[model samples]
Target chain A: MNAKIRALISEFGRLSVDVATLKNEADLYTAGLTSFASVQLMLGIEDAFDIEFPERMLNRRSFASIAAIEQAVSELLAEAGRDAEAA
Target chain B: MQTQEDYLAGLLEHGLLFSTGVDGLFGRSALFEATVDGLNALVTKHGDGFNAESVTYPPSMSRVDFEKSGYLKSFPGLAGSIHSFAGDDRAHRDLLADLEAKRDWSGRQKITDVVLTPAACYPLYPLAASRGQMPKEGLCFSLCSWCFRHEPSRDPARMQAFRQREYVRMGTAEQVVAFRASCIERGEAIVQLLELPYHLDVANDPFFGRAGKMMANNQRDQKLKFEMLIPITSDEHPTACLSFNYHQDHFGLAWGIKTADGEVAHTACVGFGMERITLALFRHHGFELANWPAGVRQALAL
Candidate 1:
């Protein structure tokens, strides 16, 4: 597994553990991924990625699942790379 | 299963001590004093090493100001108006006589171009806008303002008249998020320190109309708001004592809050209901200030 993906999963697992017991593929919502917790997750992701999540991407669908969160992070990283190169 | 009325009566009987005469809409001295002491303790402890400057605002705001910010357009239902007698005393008496006779007096009055601020932070946005660009990091302010609402509900929790203590920050998105998160943490800490049982949950502001429903949905989806609820009476449903909100770029775009680099600044606010929190404390600990826990009393320096 990619180190970034592993860290993300581990962090999500930790948060889920704090609220409820969860399997690796357990639905995050059922695992207590509340709206407030989603924000905390976003913050954690930002910290782990060292990138600022844009306002446009701060939405429920973006943080709905582990796969969605990973996709969002990849997009942000790609955008950051593009911006860096453009600069 | 005590009703809201029973809860309020219990507060009046055991918890509330009036420090000032109740001759007017204002001047509930006991409540005010307790509020000040509570806020002082909160700021001194959690807000240590932070400059705590205070701000007072006018009871009413210019209609044009609110209009410019889309408040009137958004919340016409909650807006309160100011009016003046356009005619002489004789005409006013005649109008009063007509009112006594069950006739309309609307034509005899002129609605003034002002409205009472529904919340403290409403006025600050314009001031922040006028200040131009925010510093790269941010600007933090504490505001206490007299706010009025037209909701006729007599619930003490839903007062038509109240005071709001607000802490506002304007800066980068990262700063705004961090600031809001810190407030949530500190709010939970303070509630626990006071030994007040509470729950943290997502909450939404009362938005105006159909558009408001959409706005609220967006706010919830974005995790723009969270509240700390402490039961004033029952544990099943609790009253909100503190709320933390992150206004991503909404107010920044509206009020022109900008970073030193000229980008729109993100904004966040932490609001403490001075009166409601006092009411909650009274509900939990009873009226005698002496009976409050030693640690709680010591923390408040009471």
Candidate 2:
């Protein structure tokens, strides 16, 4: 998930720095991630993880780092899982 | 004045704008105001035949709806949320002291009920949905608002706060798309009437990130956004004075705006950035409004 998240950031984020050497928890914006790029990354993450990001999850902090994205995806996946189990 | 710097300096010299020492925020001079009013009049004249429901929104709107509009999701960098110093007496005193000391105390501010209206038509979609499903012919509305973006730029055309006049159409895919095309045509006619050199071409919203890159490319490939650009600061990279956008089902889906068949209604909006258009006119006709061509003046009813 970390690798995928990083890849998505690199692909969509328009990083001003080297994505390969960047740490998973490093600040993406400081590394050159624009809000436009982050939203693109969010859409890509949704497609990759089969998770629809709820409205509340859309913000700068949600895509602040690879870890933040992973956590968000995990929460959404877990919610989906619970919903499926309930059904 | 061939350069961007020269053009900006010229506007300043001509007293077209009253600077507040901020790059993007400015007060318009009387002639500038008249020019904007002229652009507004032109837009109204051109859009009259469309039979749109005229609507106007306050410069501010609900922050909640702004979030739901996916504005922050897409353009958080440009989003302007109204903030105020909501502090106790001590904090307020500290804020004043910090200001007196020339320290950055803006962080002490709190977000208010208002988010600056990003687009003129944003509030309309939910309003349309609340009235229940759209009819077969769909709906059309005209709106004008003072919109805000956070981008502070030296370019006079890229104002942080600007007025937009928009005619929005919501209906089936065919209806909305047709409306966009008509807007493109109508937009072209007005540009011609103003006697300004312009080029209308496919454009994309500046989406963010790798996914946004793809989205931008897709929008262009599908011919979803078209910009009516005119030379402002530069001839090579003209500013978009007007835009024809086909939002497809994005707004309909987001705001629960549906057609009579319970299908997500496709949406399209054509917007005229009044200030940008006025600037374009100034760029073309020179700074003195009195010296402008009689035909152009007559076209704008100035």
lDDT of each: 0.71, 0.84
Model 2, B45-70: lDDT tens digits are 88887889998889989888888888
- Cα miss at B230, model 2 (Å)? 0.7
DockQ of 1: 0.06
Kindly give the number of clashing pairs for every candidate.
0, 7
Evaluated on chain B only, what is the TM-score of candidate 1? Answer: 0.88
Note the residue pairs that clash in candidate 1: none
- What's the TM-score of candidate 1 when only chain A is evaluated? 0.66
lDDT of 2: 0.84
lDDT, residue B111, candidate 2: 89
Model 1, span B1-302: residue lDDT tens: 45666765665565353312232133455654765667655754685533545667887888777777666655678778788788988998989998999998777888889889887888888888899887776788778777887765434565666667788888899987988888888888888877888888888778765445545566786678999998875667788888999977667877788888898888898888877787677677766777888987776767
Error of 2 at A44 (Å): 5.8
| Cα shift from native, residue B91, model 1 (Å) | 3.3
- Report how far residue B82 has shifted in candidate 2, in Å: 1.2
